[model samples]
Target: MLTTILNLLEVAAWSGIAALGFGILFNIPKSVIFTVFMLGFTAGLIKFSLMYFNVHIVLATFIAVFFVGIICMPVAHKIHHPPVVFCIPPTIPMIPGYFAYETVLSVMNFIFMEDDQAKRVELIDTIFTNGFTMIFILISIAAGISLPMLLLRKDSVKKIEE
Candidate 1:
């Protein structure tokens, strides 16, 4: 129990730092830095917690990004900046870097290896698996982030036009 809590905290802290760094890189307003950190922390916590309970990574990421999008809407309204500013930085931490890296590595290996049928088949399997997983995770993140904005567009547009 204690270990799980500590792990969650560690993930949260690191994710917050990553998000803050991206926010700085993006040149977001100084006042919004803390909010970005909190958003990142929340995203990490939600994603990690779901994964800890044995949820699939793709679904976990989608849920986490969706919640972040939902949460950022109100924060954006209060801060008077677009919700995307908050929504994007937090999601940087959730990107499946390992899967992407492995996909690329597998592809390179597949291309360079000699004509060993069994070895080639194995490499092809690895390439497809990792590549598909990475692609789905990215798709989910996009859907999760955009769904909230699309759903709330009417109200957001009305407010902006006023």
Candidate 2:
């Protein structure tokens, strides 16, 4: 129970930091929820494989997804005209930095190991896991954010036509 509580606290702190950083980077001032959601997503990405704390993963993911939805609101406003035109600010905070780092470290280990084939193989496997996981996360997050907006826009258009 104590460990779970600590992890929740950690997730909150990290999420806040991430959201603030992203908001500042993108010049979006006074975005409290944005900061929280971005940070929460990062936390979810980090704890994806933890078997003991699956609940945290779900909560963090929903929180992050909610913020991502909020962020997309303004994006939808800007790209309201040309559906193909999408504007992404620099500090969106969707990229998973830790996963990238892990991937790089794994690859480096594989390359630097002189004689341990097993270690190299293990590192290689981890590298693939990290890379694919990041890719999957990115695709899923994008889709998760985009799909709703797209559906709404389409429905609005249809309503107008009708």
Candidate 3:
């Protein structure tokens, strides 16, 4: 139990670091850095919490992204920055890099599956598994993040200096 709490904290911390790096790379303003970091941290916490409760990974990601989107509306309004600016950089940490890499690696292995039927089956199964997982995850992330903005009618906010 205690270990679970620690693990969540660790995920949040590492995710925040990744978010900050992405935000910096994307040229997110300095004032918005902390907000982006917290959003990313919150996303990690939400996903981990859902997974801890035995929710599916894709569902957890969808829920986290949707919640983050809902939260970002008020934040965008309050901070006077475009929701896209705030909403996107934070979600970068959640991209399933491992799955994407696995998808590609499995494809490569499948291509080289010379006469070994077991290896061919294994590689093909892996390719399909990782490929579909990546696709659905990306779809959920985009849809979840976009849902709130679709409902909101406000124009994009311009960056204001503090």
Candidate 4:
């Protein structure tokens, strides 16, 4: 659908900006900024598309990151930098900040609030749900993003000529 694609594009743009900030933090060189932006944009688009299709968020993240990793391989080969330089930057935007933040808030509330039996149980439930989801999603994204290195027949980085 045109509307879906347009929405995806908007998500990609915002995600690209986030990834660009991470790229700067990661010391990614200026020359590859576009590539890095595209990486995040594409990853976010893929993830969004899968989610739109009613895919599980964790599964969508894995698929998206795996796709990004595959795409990064050739780009890294062409640019002569390590694949991680390209791969990790894009995945930055995929980090589930909302879930992570909620997990933290849940823990803080559980710890700081005076113990009422009903409230304590409720807080624990929230913490477990958000915390586990946050941890697993992060792991899923990292694993998916890095799997290419393990699975690819070619080396991820070129050997420097001495």
Candidate 5:
């Protein structure tokens, strides 16, 4: 129990830091950096918590990004910035970097390995698996961020214009 909590905290803390760094890199307003951190923390907590309980990574990422979008709407209005400013940074922390790296590594191995059919087959499987997982996770993140904005377009746009 304690270990799970600690793990979640660690993930959240690192996620927040990553988001804050991205926010800084993006040149977002100084006032919004803390909000970005909190959003990242919430996103990491939600995604990893779901994964810990056996949820698929793609679905977990979608749900987490969706919640971040919903939460960012009001904050965007208050800050007079688009919700995307808040949404993008938080979602950055959830990107499947490991899967992408593995995909590349597998491809390299496939290219270098001798004509051992068994190893070739395994490498092909690994490449497709990691590549597909990474692609789907990215798609889910895009959908998650876009869905809320599409659903709340009127309100979000109107509020920003006000």
Candidate 6:
């Protein structure tokens, strides 16, 4: 129980760091900092939970992105500008950088270790498959959130013109 709480705290800390960093960089208002923090916190929770089940990082990224995007949609709507910027900063917690770096290292090791062709092949294959999955998740999140908003804006413009 203690360990779980500690782990949760750690997740919160990292999420806050990511959120605060982006918020400051983008000049988001101090009043909205908590909102960004929570967005990042939820993304971290989703990523960590999926990672616990040994779900591929790509799938995990997708889940985090989709969940955060939906949760922030109403907030985004209220902003009346490029609300996707909010989601982009908040999604930083779901980048899976560690997994990606490890995957790259494993590939490099496999290439240099000339004795085991089979292991090399396996490493390379996992890199491609898992990498593809991760990329797809990131793209899906961006597309899923942005496309609807874009279309809505276009329709509003058409109505104004008419």
Q: Which digits, one per residue and each the tens of the lDDT, describe model 3 over residues 5-70? A: 999989988888898899999999888999998999999899988999999889999999998888
Query: Scored by CA lDDT, what does every candidate get?
Result: 0.87, 0.52, 0.84, 0.84, 0.87, 0.69
Higher lDDT: candidate 2 or 5?
5
Task: List RMSD in Å for every model shown.
Answer: 2.3, 6.5, 3.3, 3.1, 2.0, 4.5
lDDT score of residue 130 within candidate 4 = 89
Over all chains combined, what TM-score does candidate 4 have? 0.88
Best candidate per TM-score, number?
A: 5
Q: Model 1 TM-score?
A: 0.91
State the weakest 10-residue window (summed lDDT) of model 1. Answer: 153-162
Q: What is the TM-score of each candidate against the true structure?
A: 0.91, 0.59, 0.90, 0.88, 0.93, 0.68
Clashing pairs in 6: none
TM-score computed on alpha carbons, candidate 5: 0.93
The pairs that clash in candidate 5 are none
The parts of candidate 6 lying over 4 Å away from their true place are: 50-56, 77-82, 112-115, 147-162
- Put down candidate 5 lDDT per residue, 44-66, tens digits, no spaces: 99999999999999999999999
When 4 and 6 are scored with lDDT, the better candidate is: 4
Q: At residue 110, give the lDDT of candidate 5.
A: 87
Which has the better TM-score: candidate 3, or candidate 5?
Answer: 5
Local error of candidate 1 at 152, Å?
3.0
| TM-score of decoy 2 | 0.59
| Candidate 3 Cα errors over 4 Å, as ranges | 153-162
Model 2: CA > 4 A from native? 29-63, 70-94, 154-162
Give the Cα error of residue 39 in candidate 2, in Å: 8.9
